[model samples]
Target: MHRSERVSMYGWIWRHLPGNTWVRAGISLVLVLATVFVLFQYVFPWAEPLLPFGDVTVDEGGAGR
Candidate 1:
């Protein structure tokens, strides 16, 4: 996106936020925490079984002996 579009989007978000800096900061923090909680609780568990992250096997030659 262009610089003006980016700035406008940010300005829009800032204007929609409910309060001064501290309250907005608190709201942003809550949003971030909620996003993390949802991902860990629901998304990660559902995706865990589909990932190829299990049963790693490695073979090493005896040349180091």
Candidate 2:
């Protein structure tokens, strides 16, 4: 693919972000925080039930005793 088409999602976002270096940095930080908030507040909780981690079993009476 061409360079433009090969550009990463992050690179595309950076190019589209408005303002100078400092303002762009601030906006990037806000975007990151917003993404994390959404993942933790909605995504993780919603997907938790679908994960296999809840079925974990431990061999308490076996090795490492």
Candidate 3:
């Protein structure tokens, strides 16, 4: 089968996960939490300086003066 017809990486992981449905759900939740922790602790901080969010502009002394 073609790559597009193949199962997604997430689907493959879910199928390969051990135990029953509840166990898979718990594992999935842990994976999500770990992913989020890594992003906030490392990825976001490293990428913050390269992002345009810090260039925010605000109206001084109220709007429509």
User: Which candidate leads in lDDT?
Assistant: 3
State, as a TM-score between 0 and 1, how close model 1 is to the true structure: 0.70
C-alpha lDDT of all candidate models, in order: 0.84, 0.91, 0.94
* Candidate order by decreasing TM-score: 2, 3, 1
Single out the weakest 10-residue window by summed lDDT for candidate 2: 55-64
Backbone clashes counted, model 1 = 0
Model 2, global lDDT? 0.91
Q: lDDT tens string, model 2, 1-65?
A: 77767878888888899999899999999999999999999999999999999786888787768
Give per-model TM-scores.
0.70, 0.80, 0.72
TM-score of 3: 0.72
Clashes of 3: 0
Pairs with steric clashes in candidate 3: none
lDDT of 3 by residue, 1-65 (tens): 89769888999999999999999999999999999999999999999999999786887867877
Give the runs in model 3 whose Cα sits over 4 Å from its true position: 1-6, 56-65
Angstrom error of the Cα, residue 21, model 3: value is 0.8
Model 3, poorest ten-residue lDDT window? 56-65
* Full candidate order by lDDT, most accurate first: 3, 2, 1
